[model samples]
Target: MITTTMSASERFELSSYRIPGSDSCFYIPEFITEGEEAYLIRKVAPGFRPALGPSIYERLQIRDSPVQRWKQLANRRLQLWGGELTSNNVLVAQPMPSFVETYPDIINRLQQTGVFHGSPHGKPNHIIMSLVPSTDPSQTRADDSPGTKFVPCLLCVVDIFLTVEVCVCVRVRSMSQAKTVPPRSSSTPSMSNRQLQPHEDGPAYHPAVATISLNSHCVFHYYRYTLPESHGGRSIDPTPVLSLLLEPRSVVISTDSLYSNRLHSYVPPFQARLGMPDQRARRIHEIKEDRFTAGGAADFVSPIANWERVTDAATREVLANGGALTRGTRYSLTCRDVGKVAQLKSFVKR
Candidate 1:
């Protein structure tokens, strides 16, 4: 998005990356170096997160091993730092690992962006590491489970022989935005890799959110919650509000209303056949993530709010050519600040 010369941390012209209709959002590309991304990936991975200090682990009685902190969800794998929130939306404070709490790779870099200037903690106290499962057809099962099982969402990929019917872009708008769900686990597609159900972040945290994408690229969307309606007996279609390409090592900073007021979801990374074509072509199998059945396609158009600000040439070309791009393994560090923290030690017994 915005590129400006400034300090030793980052070079960002934040205003240049704002989303048009949004109150405040900055889509900054190359926010971290490739080496930094790799290091973050290793640190954030659940089984590989840097181990807790021996003294602290011993005091807590947790094994000093690489504690399996990762929790696999219905659609994505997650590793939460700063402990999990309770049913009442209380975040039991647990000191974050060195990589996040004290290390300068992410939090330090984010501070330079100045997006968290007025946050409760003056910085993000909670971080959720998310990774969508790969969508390769080889993982498809006869039962049509996650990787390759088709669930109708905003887009569908149906192909017949050498031809395909896929809708790359669609017109989606936000009708309303107001809801307060518990900060509980969410169920989504990680493998046919199904798309996540459209939803908003919990409102318990500060209204600002900074998402850092790493390793691979992804298409993240912002939309209001509205169920499809059958109009004039026509097929039901989803309505999306805004779309953006999240390039690797890039960070999307959304503040005020966008992060706190609307729903967001990421498309599944894998492709699946929506139907079995003529029996003669049963042997043909080449996965195209965006190919869908046009017989039931939605109105398509590339309306990414920050398309012009996109700095990646390849992503620009893909958007330029019908606005369809393949999904890849994406690891996102979703950082936020939760003002209310209950000490976990209070609940632990001696």
Candidate 2:
């Protein structure tokens, strides 16, 4: 079954464009053709359904091709695929289902991205595609209370919690039902908007996150570290060091500094704009110019610091290109590895 799901032709073609100075991380623009993009959107539609209750809508969220639409949440909006992280930070073992894996070119190119080179599986074992609704007052609640209501919640109509274990690898068709409530915060609401904090991705899974931007274009914010002290009650600082212009159909792999050293989040702006020309801007929605980046060294791409410890030169070559690295409504396939499978089952059963 796994072999059948793995397509021979579906791999990243431009294997040369990788990020410089970084150990891991890769970027590929137009990783998927316009037609494939439409096909994926159509395939995910059926899986989108209410999870908890009727209040929330569960369905694949995407606008017409070239226009990215981000689904909103209190903190931010993101789609979850594969399976939820176990309480201990491990993902249950399972193959990335056919609907996702059928695109071999995209996956194969990513294999060379170097993000997954160190994992036990030697490639991304799971994938997730989701749309983050633009952040706004509607996304927030009345009292300004912080919790899942503030974050956003997906209603899981299905009570399917793979109790039997089986290294069950299932994709979250839509995050409409997943809990988006915010954890205890530290600092006062400093920024006009809230976002994902900059912190090392915990050992919950592997150390890489491969994101594909779709719909509109937006900048993903990254911070150096958590706040020195928890101000509002939360301890992390989700700020923007630099922003990645996530274009529709582009693929961005988050590993090394992009993944381990810093925190990443989407910045929701009232008016999104793209610095590039109208022809290029039209490829995505809410194109923004200078939303995050400044001038000089900032103009060129810089690899995440501390990433050298993780990957080799061959893998880094695939990330530097200018393909499908759009911003708005981006979906990420965070490939990771949990530990020994048989032992994991024993632990989960307990």
Best by lDDT: 1
What TM-score should be assigned to candidate 1?
Answer: 0.66
lDDT of 1 by residue, 1-350 (tens): 44432333665656766777676778877777676676666555323221221111111111221343446676666767767788887788876667654444577677777788887788888888776644444322222332212222235343323444442211221123312223323353224246665566786788888998876777666766445445633221243456667778888888877776677766642221211111111223332423232211122342566666667777666555543555545678899888778887877853
Model 2 TM-score (2 dp): 0.52
Candidate 1 colliding pairs, count: 22
What range of 10 consecutive residues in model 2 has the weakest lDDT sum? 161-170
Off by over 4 Å in 2: 1-16, 19-25, 47-80, 104-109, 134-194, 226-239, 269-332, 339-350
lDDT of 2 by residue, 1-350 (tens): 00112123554333343544334545555555666665664544434322221123323333222222334554444444444456665665444445565553455556765557777777665555554533344432222345443222234333222221121112342246544445546555423244343445676556777776544444554556544664554343322344444445666666655677766655443323323211122322232432232211122232232222212233223233322222223344444554433333665688
For each of the candidates, the C-alpha root-mean-square deviation to the true structure, in angstroms, is 16.4, 13.2
| TM-score of each model, in listed order | 0.66, 0.52
lDDT of 1: 0.57
